[model samples]
Target: MPRPKRPGEAQDVGAFPPAEAGITVVDWIDERTSLSPGIRWMLFRKVPKGINWAYTLGSATLFAFLAQAVTGVFLAMYYRPDAAGGAYESIRYITDDAFLGQFVRGMHKWGASVMIILIFLHMARVFFYGAYKYPRELTWIIGVVLLILTLVMGFTGYLLPFDQRAYWATIVGVNINGTGPFVGPFLSDFLRAGPEFGATTLSRFYAIHMLLVPGAIGALIGAHLYLVSKLGITAPPWLKAEPEPELLEHSEV
Candidate 1:
């Protein structure tokens, strides 16, 4: 060994220094893209002091929706939508042949149900706490629209298997749509693509399930999140009577 090294002496460096290399890459990207500030603002935003377990339902719902989207994408890769007769067989093949197919499909199915329940619970929490009053009315309205979209997403996806239950349930749903007085026939025809379900109907439901509903949900969620950031989390009822603290002042750069 060389002469005893000093306590703070530099050690031999490895050929690849992962930590330093990562920081350097991040610094390079941040310098050029200016992304760090926005990311920090989103990640480090302040919340009200009284936030409790009830506030977590919305985040849970979002997580469940993300799971559904991911699993749905994987399922879509092997799904056959154009052929009604082939739909069940395709699902069977996915369950039997594809890697992790059944697991992903099960997650998507259960995730939809869980998301619905969480969304309802979130709405209930907000409603019970009177968080929907006054400044948050628009937020509540957007949330209701999101809830409807989620329900529609489930309805459209229910028929993808093209099995007996799906077929009959869709028939009933289309018929129910047709009972809407003035727009009933048009709505029914649009959904079924004719008097009866066909290839067009399957294709329509698939498009709505995979693209239209998901896209709408994503846009609404973005708007909802922006509104939440702007308005901040609503304080609990008990905190309403207390005076709030003054905003913290920042020094000029």
Candidate 2:
């Protein structure tokens, strides 16, 4: 028990200052926890013995995202997004002039698709297992945001190649946006950077695809990961603890 101080008695002080209270906190935490073969185990935690394959999709999505980021950086080094005829020429340079350009672009495109598939699979797992319950509501919300970002990434990337397919895709995309209810026209105009697809549109898409979209995705992913860490992984709802038969036999003896 802590003592009540007398009139002139010195008050007991914590080992560290209030602002440095974390040091004291660490000291207390260290006393209560121990490492097992280089891994720290939280008190009262029991490692789950069985988990479904759905749990792995989140990891796959993360890997895909990383792959896309790396390949995108490499492609950006040689890509020139222009409404001018130089678009095809620049891409040709990337293919013919830059080292490993074809492989990088292929990897980026394929990686984006893989990310989409993995995210969907992860979401399905969460739904089926009811992992999106109680304390995990925020994680699900962030997952939705991440899904939207993945789509945005796909849309932004569609224009980078600057081919006939890209040109028509942006045209259809802007037209769809232009049909908005209230601020749709404004958003479309803002997105395209002009009334019609031209040099401005190419510049806008390039900036967004290369910098802005990736930045937004990065921020959201960071938040999602932080929340997941805070909430901890949710095991399947149907899961039950199993007793060890060997231990039970020994206890009976």
Candidate 3:
């Protein structure tokens, strides 16, 4: 018969740890992909020390987008996106009963505008830096797609209040959709959820603005960040040359 093992001895083959004591799948994942390692993996890898204020816009834009999403969630709790006293009464409740509702709404509105501007600035910085070349091409393409989605989110958000502006804007939008060949009417029906804008239309836009668009934005951001990590930062052309001291000495000699 096999001898009994000591307290600190290793278990025999085919033995397993107790269920409650065993490591979890999450533990395995954390061990393999811990971002806590340092800044090198999280960010700042290969990024130049001279990165100017313009390079900061991407992070600022992302922060603004997150702030808008959180504020919109709060606003959604108090605002009714329907035709039954929705446009004016909802505004009254937000401005009256809901503490900081007006501020939240105002912040979301202005943040959207700021996010748009910052994203453009960020894109311009990347473009001028030639950051879209070769290995970073997919990130650039995803950024373009994200830009289109951002505009869509803004347009969809503009229709949520059910006011005259929302009504006429959606009407024009529906008309444009209805003008397309073949499935134009179908597309309009799908978007409007009927022949024209109504209570249902308001609810649909609210859903898209609050849920669908944000979800897509989140997914695109993930893809963009993943591509950036995969490619790493591209060094400037000048930085890619021999060291400054070597070049200087060679020129002097």
- Runs in model 1 deviating more than 4 A are 1-16, 244-253
What would the per-residue lDDT of candidate 1 be over residues 1-253, giving only the tens digit for each residue?
2355578987655444676788889999999999999778766888877889999899899899899998999898999986547888998888888988888888988888899999999999999989898898999999999999999998999999888888899899889889999999999989988877776899899999999999999999999988887787787877755443443244332
Q: Which stretches of candidate 2 lie over 4 Å from their true place?
A: 1-47, 241-253
The whole-model C-alpha lDDT of candidate 2 against the native structure comes to 0.79
Per-residue CA lDDT of candidate 3, range 1-253, in tens? 3358889988674454466334556567668887445445657566655456776777898898899889988887788876776656787778777888878888988899999999999898899889898878889998998898898888888887667787799889878979999999999998888876656877888788888989999999988877777677665444554467857877855
Candidate No. with top TM-score: 1
Q: What lDDT score is found at residue 179 in candidate 3?
A: 98
Candidate 2 per-residue C-alpha lDDT over 1-253 given as tens digits, one digit per residue, 9 for 90 to 100: 4477799988887643576577667767766774332233322344365676778888788889889888888787777776777777888887777787777777887888889998999999989888899998988998898898788888878887788898899789888978989998888889888776767788787788778878888898878776666667776777786678987887855
Worst 10 residues of 1 by lDDT: 244-253
Ranking by lDDT: 1, 3, 2
Which one wins by lDDT: 2 or 3?
3
Please give the RMSD of candidate 3 to the true structure: 7.1
Better of 1 and 3 by lDDT: 1
